[model samples]
Target: MMTLLSAPTSPYVRKVMVVAHETGQIDRIDPVFALANPTKANEELNNQNPLAKIPALVTEDGAIFDSRVICEYLDATTSTHPLFPRDGKTRWQALTQQALADGLLDAALSARYELLMRPEDKQWSGWRDAQLAKIERALDRMNTDIPDTLTIGAVGYGCALGYLDFRFPEVDWRAARPALADWFATFSERPSMQATLPRD
Candidate 1:
């Protein structure tokens, strides 16, 4: 079985797990809990992934890192439900959607890190506010262009929105984006998403 360095609370790891569940490849992966913090070092994780990131898949070929690459690799393993489109305009659109969701996650993480990781004296409200603003803009874009197909883009959006609910409930993103909220409610019912719900 391939090894998946993971953490229950990591949205990126959750994304990979959701894909594994969706593609009927969950049985093939062995999840190994790994700690990865930006300001700290995790030698075990660093050895496999220079970036010390979670959701790195250790395969016979080598270690595949970061969620996007690993998700694509997993999608290729089975034809059960191809998350990545083969080619053409749909491919680009799906990829763009994934990028948008990932960007939202990046901003959310940045905002959280500023409050949780930075020393109180060093933390900057302005920076955190900027990150939150970015997330708000991304939410508006996602609401405007919800994914109509089940691709990696949909998975990305699901995971990103779930992360917000898990970590930033105070943000109240649903009030302004009812359509996206409704989409997530339905998406969350999928076994893939239900099984990989983010938690601390």
Candidate 2:
């Protein structure tokens, strides 16, 4: 079994958990609850991930950091329902869509840190607005063409959208992106997503 540094409310960690469940490899994972937060560094987690992020998988071979890499590793190792497409234009599309969804997450987190983590005196509203703009653009793209297959792109979008709902409910993402919202409403029903919902 592999050890996964996990935090209950971390959307990145939640993404890996959902991937594990979707790939039918959840049993092979041993989740070690860790209270990792952006405000402080975790020495133990840093041992596994130099950047001290959760969802770091300690494998027999070594350690894999970042949810994207870990999720791909799981998909590559699993023979069952692969979340990542193997080849063709569809594969490229899936990878690209995954990047788009991940960008939304990155921007959202950047805004969060700027507004919530930094001291009010040091926080820059311009920087926060810039990040939020990136998220809005990404969401517009996702709404224009939502993923139709259960690929890595879908998984990434699911986690990103869920995180927005969990943290930025005031954004009203559904107001303009009805297609993306509808797609996510259905995706949220998946057992993998249902089991990995982020909680306080």
Residues 129-197, model 2: lDDT tens digits: 999999999999999878988999999899999999999999999998889989999999999999999
CA shift of 69, model 1, Å: 0.2
lDDT of each: 0.93, 0.90
Q: Largest lDDT belongs to which candidate?
A: 1
The C-alpha stretches of model 2 lying farther than 4 A from their native spots are none
Model 2, TM vs. native: 0.96
Consecutive 10-residue window with the lowest summed lDDT within model 2: 34-43
CA lDDT, candidate 2, residue 159 = 94
Q: List where candidate 1 sits over 4 angstroms from the true fold.
A: none
